[model samples]
Each structure stands twice: as structure tokens, then as C-alpha cells.
Target chain A: MFTLYEFASSGNCYKLRLAMAQLDIPFQRIEKDITRGETRSAEFLAINPNGRIPVLVTPDNRVLPESSAALWYLARDSKLMPEDPFQQAQVLQWMFFEQYNHEPNIATSRYWIHVLGEQEKYAEALAEKQQKGHDALAVMETHLSDRDFFVGRDYSIADIALYAYTHVAGQGGFSLDAYPAIRGWLERVERQPGYVAMEA
Target chain B: MFTLYEFASSGNCYKLRLAMAQLDIPFQRIEKDITRGETRSAEFLAINPNGRIPVLVTPDNRVLPESSAALWYLARDSKLMPEDPFQQAQVLQWMFFEQYNHEPNIATSRYWIHVLGEQEKYAEALAEKQQKGHDALAVMETHLSDRDFFVGRDYSIADIALYAYTHVAGQGGFSLDAYPAIRGWLERVERQPGYVAMEA
Candidate 1:
């Protein structure tokens, strides 16, 4: 059996849970409270020296961390991944955008504003973060304007990567009202086959 | 023919160029001056609404952007990508690390200290950037102490992503002396077949 070390509130951890659910793959889950520094413990450090959540340990004793990487691992040769070369790269393109443009802005804001509750200390960085965050959202809005899904008219890991955090972006102070296309796309992803809510 | 739009100094763009050279894939190169805001031009924005560099236009008129995505596009079904499902995900793990931990610290510092010439403005941020940058380097140091490459024993996209900026990290005011393993690994990558150097 696969074992996943996950954090309940982390989108990165949620990605693994969501993928496992969608694939109907059973796994033992060990929840680490990231807020309490549970991931930094010696035992957990042995699993992933990076001290991060969502470390997926395979049955063969291979440990794979990083949510996107875990998604690729679980979905390879399965219906979750695209067989076409170009289509697969498109999925990666969106995933990279999620990391570079999307996550840095949205995730940072979430950490500072919501997690740390340090609006005053991080006040200067907030404007830049908000601008970059909005820019990322704008790009996503444009791309989703004409698509039912991120790639090949199906829900792939790309959707999983982006959806993990985007659905909860409102908690980070981003308004969904301006991004109608993204909002619509979010609904479509929620209605996907075998879909499971983050906490459900 | 593959047409690549990139700037000389972008490590992300360098990843694609390095992969293309390794694959022996011939392509036309179009230089985009990211520093002067050329990526934001109306024409460039038409091809990539995100207006980012390292956009690859394939023969079928499909445009693939983002460095990691483009590398996968070029290496898909080739010997560059591992056929094993788990190993391929291992590659993605390092690639994601390159994005989240490595790029944010090392790449951002290089862009700021070396390219932007805004050291004073970035004083506090640079301090934090250096700490995080060194932390990431330590992670690579520990991983490389035992293995030749990041994923499998063979060279893959994982090396391409990290090596692009790492060799030139000194330009970002980072010291390689502390991480002997990473330093040695850089040499190993440099000695690889079809290895290419980023512009000095």
C-alpha cells in the first residue's frame, strides 16, 4: 500500500489526496500539522529532507515528494494523463505557470495574509504580490475562457495542480468576481468524474 | 521547424536550448529582449498571452511556453525521458524543487543582483534570498553526495532544469565553495554528451 504524509490545510498535500481519490487508489495517510512544525520532526525529516508535506511512499519503499511529481507518478500510464505528446506538454506548461507565476503570488499572499496574519509586517510586499497574483489570474482567465478543461477536453493533473489552491484563493483575498471564466472553469472541474472535495 | 523565442540570460530559456541541443533537434531562434520589455509587445503577446520568454512554436503551429514544459515536449517519447513511471516522477520532483525552492532564491537573486542592478533596493530581500538560496544549495549538496544525477543514474530533464542557473550562480552573489557535492555534480553535468553552456 502507498502511504502519504499529508497536511490537511496545505494545497500541496491536498493535491495528493485529490489525485489518490480520483484514481481510487487506496493509501494510508499520516497527517502532519505544518502549522505546528510537525513536518520538521526527525522521523519526518528522514522521509523527506526537504521537510515538506505530501511525501508519497510507494509500496516498493520509494519515496516521492512534491505534489506535481506525485501526480505524474500516480497518473502515468493511467487515464489521468494524456497519451499525446503535445497535449502532455500543455499540461506541463500550465503546471509550470502554476509554480512560477501563480503559486509565488497567490501562495505567498495566502501565507502572509491568512497563515501568518502579518499584514502589517508584510505590507510592502503585499502590493507587488497582489499585482503579480492578479496577472496570473488574468492569464488563467484568458486561457479558460474557451476551454472546458486545461487540456484535451479532460481533467488531468494540470487541473489538479491548479485547482488545489485556486478554489481557495478567496481566503487569500483574491476576488473571484472578476474572473468569470476561471470561476466557470472551477465549476466544471468540480463536476468532473470521480471528483472529490479537498476535505471530503 | 521549431522556432524558439528566448533571451540569452534566462536560465529557464537555457533549459530548453540545452535540451534541443542534446536531442540534436534543429530550430530557428528568435531573440526576445526581456529586459527591455519586448515580451510585452503586442506581437509577442499574441503568441503567448503570458508574454514570457522561451516559447516554442512547433511545425503544426502549436506554441508551447515555459521551459520545463518545452523540455518535456522535446524529450517526450525519446531516450531523454525515462520509460519507467516512477523514475519519470522522480524527475518531476527535482523539477518542481527547481521551481519552488531553487528558482525563487537562486534565479531571483541572479536576476536582481546581476541583471537589475538594484542591490540597495533589494538589500533586505537579498539577505533572505541568500539564506534560502544557500538552504536550497545544501539540499542539492546532500542529494548529490551519493548520486551522479538527480533521478536515475542517467541524465534527464531534472539536471537540465537545475544546471541551467546553478553553474552561473556566482553571478547572483551565491558561493559554491560550501557545497562540494553540488560543485562536483556540476562538473559531471558539464562532461555529459551534448552538454551546452549558457552565455557568459
Candidate 2:
């Protein structure tokens, strides 16, 4: 059994949950409120010194931290991970983009404008955030326009990674009106077998 | 043939270079000056719409972005990527930790303090960076204390991902004296076949 320590609102945490559901891998969930700093507790720190959510405790007592890492673990050797070298690399390429470009812009903007409630204070930053966020989305919109999935023409961890935040990007104040391709792709991912909503 | 668009000082780019050298895979190198914003140019962005350096272009003109992703591509079906399901996840787990905890801290700190010398401007954020950077180093120090490599007791992409930035962490105004374990691991990575210096 895998025990997951997560925050329900976190896209990173959601990545793990969605992947586990896709694989039909049974796991336990322990929620942590990052805003209140529950992750800093001594007990939690012992498990993950980084004190972040979505830490997966394996059956063998090995604790794995990081959401994408957990997803990679759950989908390992499964259909979620591509068999070909180039296709596998394609999955990772998008994952990296999620972290470096997409997440930083879209996820950060969403956190600031919606969750933080300091939109005015962050207005200037938000403008840049939206632009960069859209830039990332635009790239995705173009790529997804012609493909059913991010790589290998099959659903993979890359979709799981990008889907987590993208589905709720509007909550972060990012309008998806222009990204019809990405929107369609999201529907495709949502329809995957064993799919689980973030709130679910 | 693989053509890598990279910057000499970037740890992310260095990871790909190091891996290629280790595998004795020859590839053409196209150095980009990130500081000059070469990555944002139309030509470069065409290769990688994300406008990021370390984009790997295959013979077929397919462009793959992200350093870790590029490493995955080069290592796919090779010995560098772990074969076992659990072990591969372990590798990814560490890689994700590097991005969220380690890279954001150590790598960002190095860039701000050493490369840009904007410590005063980032002073308010400096304390947080310092704390997080030190904390990330602590995790690496402890992990390396017990293992020769990040996963499976052999050099893999995990080591390659981490070694890229850590070896030059000192260049970012971080001291190596506090991390003897990491220093020792650095030596081990250096001694690996086809070890390439950061500036090389």
C-alpha cells in the first residue's frame, strides 16, 4: 500500500492522486494544509525534511516526495510511461515544461490572484504572469491542437502533470477561452479510465 | 546527430553535455547566451516555443526541451535510466525533489548572488533563499552520506541531474566546506568515465 501526504488544492498533489486513480493503484491519503504550515511539524519533517506535500510512503517504508515523481512511480512500467526512447523523452520534455514554464506562470498566477486575495498588490506581477502563462498555454494549445495527447498519441504522465493545474487554471484567474485545443485535451484526459477529479 | 543548444555556465545544460560525454555519444553543441536573451529569439523559440536553452534537436528536426527531459531521451533504453519499476520511480522522485526543493533554492541562490550580484535587491528574499538552499544541500549531503549515487549504487540520470548544479554551487557564493559528503560525491562523479568540467 502507498500512503500519500497531500494538500487537496495543490496541483502537485493532484498529479499523484490522478495518476494513482488512472493506474487503479490503491493508496491512502493524508491531507496537509501548507498555508498553516502543518508540513513543518517535527514528525512530518522526519519523513520529508523538505516538508512538502504529496509524499508517498511505499510498502517497503521508503518515502517518496514530489508529485511528478510520485506519478512517475505509480505509472512506472505501465501504459502511462511510453516504451520508446524518444516518446519517453517527449513525456519528460513536457513535464519539465510544466515545472519551468507552465507551472511557474499559470500555477503561480492562480495562487497569487485567487488564493492569496492580494490581486491588487500583485497586479503588476499578475500582468506579466498572465502573459507568460498564456505564452505557455499557447505553446500547449498549438501542440495539443493536432494531437490527442502530449506524447506517443496516448495518455501519459505528461498529460497527468499538465492536467492537474490546467483544469483549474480559471480559478487562478486564467481564462481558457482562447485555448480550445488545450480545453479539448483536458476533456480527453478527464475521460481516461479510472480518472479522479482533484476534489474527488 | 543531436544538436544541443546550451549555455556553458548552465547546470541544466551541463547535465546533457555530461551525459553525452559519458555515453560517448557525439553531438553538436550550439552555445547560447541566456543572459543576452538569445533563447527568446524567433529562431530559437521556433526550436523551443518555450524559448528556453538546452533544447535538444534530433536529426528529424524534432525539438525536445528541458535538461532532465533531454537526459531521459539520451538515456532511454540505455543503462543510465534504471530498468526496475520501483528504482525508476526512485530516480524520478529525487529528480522532482531537485526541481522543487533543491534547484529553486540552490540554483536560484547561485544565480542571484554569484552570477547577477544582486544580493541587495534580493535581500528580503535572500534569507528565505539562504535557508531553503541550505536545507536542500542538507538533504543532498545526508543522502550522499549513505550512497555512492542517488539511486541503485550506480551513476544514472539522477546523479547527472543533481551534479550539474551542485558542483558549481560554490560559484553562487555557497561554501562547499559544510558538505563533505557532497564534496566527496562530487569527486566520485568527476572520476566517472567521460566526466566533463562545467566550463568544458
Give the top-scoring candidate (DockQ).
1
Residue pairs with backbone atoms closer than 3 Å in model 1 (clashes): none
TM-score of 1: 0.96
Query: Where is the poorest 10-residue window by lDDT in model 1 chain B?
Result: B76-85
lDDT for each candidate structure: 0.87, 0.83
Error of 1 at A94 (Å): 0.7
TM-score of the B chain in model 1?
0.96
CA deviation > 4 Å runs, candidate 1: A116-121
Clashing pairs in 2: none
Once fitted onto the true fold, the runs of candidate 2 whose alpha carbons sit more than 4 angstroms away are: A112-128, B59-61, B112-128
Fnat score for model 1: 0.95
Judge candidate 1 at residue B167 and give its lDDT. 92
Chain B TM-score per candidate, please.
Answer: 0.96, 0.93
By DockQ thresholds, what CAPRI class is model 2?
A: medium
- Compared with the true structure, model 2 gives a TM-score of 0.90
